[model samples]
Target: MPNFNNLQYASEPGSPTSPSEDWAQATADLIVVLDGATARTETGCSHGISWYAEHLGKSLLLAAADTTLSLVGVAKSAISRVACLHPECDLTHPGTPSAGIAMLRPDGRYFVLGDVAIVAESTDGIAVIVDERVSQTGVAERAEVDHYLIGTPEKAAALLPMKRAELAARNIPGGYWIAAADPAAADHALVGHLGLDDGAPVAVLTDGAARAEVFGLLDWAGLLDLAVAAGPLELIQRVRAAENSDPLGAKWPRNKASDDATMVTASVAS
Candidate 1:
């Protein structure tokens, strides 16, 4: 069985009331990391983004525990299960809470939905898989959100319109898929299996944890090395420090100064 080494995680809300919408679950044989979508518009459900994300994450953990179901099958079922919890709300509402997901199965297969990052290391090298469809689909909206940079009054003013557009794009044609009420979105997830010889040193990350490489702070190899040497929480702190150095995103523009960061790493047994 693979073991989680340097098993650590850190999650800070983008804002105090926002609630950290990221979650993770791990067993000797399974690992999952999820980043819940922030509500761009008002959701009819009083429970809000945090509520939906928690239910969805818990449901996913339960469904994936089955082990026998195909990954996609379980993922879709989980979406449907979460949706059933709120029959009173407009499930099709663009502001509905959702999440990006990454899962590692005992069979050496890994799956991804939305922009979650999954990296596996072996003698060959490092392989990172991310689904960019979400980012791509909301390009214009993202630009609008980024226009004034996070933390700026102007950006705050534009947030509602920008997020409305962002929310509108979900699950539509040319829009990206996510773990929302619609399970069919699971069909677009990224999936792959590791080779038997693909050794240990696997790292699964939320986008925040991946900023080191994504922002050119470290290469993939260095990321794996750092996780082993410093522990996963340290890696997140490093990101926090980096973001603090440019809180308004002057040097490195971004949607927010810091996002909820989370990671889980596992090493192959010898």
Candidate 2:
């Protein structure tokens, strides 16, 4: 059996709210993390991002309940429904529109979208599966484009035309996975999966917690070693420190740049 643990924290860089992130876990088969996109519209439907994230989390939990669909199928179904609610935007579009998802399954099938990072460690060391971030759009240039994922319904309605045009111009292909090439200034979107099997443990982290800086500043490998020796909660603390420290952050910069952090650590038993 694979043993796992997860933790999440959201710091409201703008809103009065403490955190704008959400997470879900499945002991029997899967683990997921969803980050709400910044809203750009005023339709009040922009809250749709949160609703989408939370809804996806719940859908995953419930779909797994059916014990029929694989984790991928469950996620697909949830995403499909969420996409339906906001016809203005489509999940398969080219831009880094609004949502993200990462999952680890019992069969060693792990899938991810957005800029979340997943690390698997074993005797082979560590294999990092990182979601591509959208390329940087520049601090100044972004202002002209409205810097946020649609949040409220009104915003969703209002931004639909602009977003649609943007999508059309980009020639967004239908059914493409969504993601950011650079979470900070993303332009490209993504969705993909990788197989994991080796004599080791697995860890998945949001961009904030697993950036190159965290690894350089704290000896990420050493930290992972310590986490294995100590436990997930302590490892969670280490990630927390990385977020606060921004040890290697100079390499990666963002506009609305506060990252919601989440990390899941697991061991594949012999």
Best by lDDT: 1
Full-model lDDT for every candidate: 0.77, 0.50
| RMSD to truth, every model | 2.2, 8.0
Model 2 Cα lDDT, one tens digit per residue, 1-270: 543443322222223364455454546456666655544433224334555567667766776676676555666666565556566644443443355667776456676665566666633556566654322212233333344333334434545554444333332333223422212211233334444453355666565555433446445565456555665446555555554454323333333234555556666532
**Model 1 score (lDDT):** 0.77
Per-residue lDDT value at 269 in model 2: 39
Worst 10 residues of 2 by lDDT: 179-188
| lDDT (Cα, tens digit) per residue for candidate 1, span 74-193 | 899889998888888887666677889898864568889988888777545677788888777556666777777667888877777767766777877777788888899888888878
Measured with C-alpha atoms, the lDDT of residue 172 in candidate 1 is: 75
lDDT of 2: 0.50
Task: List residue ranges in candidate 2 displaced over 4 A.
Answer: 1-18, 41-46, 66-68, 83-97, 122-124, 136-176, 179-199, 212-215, 226-252
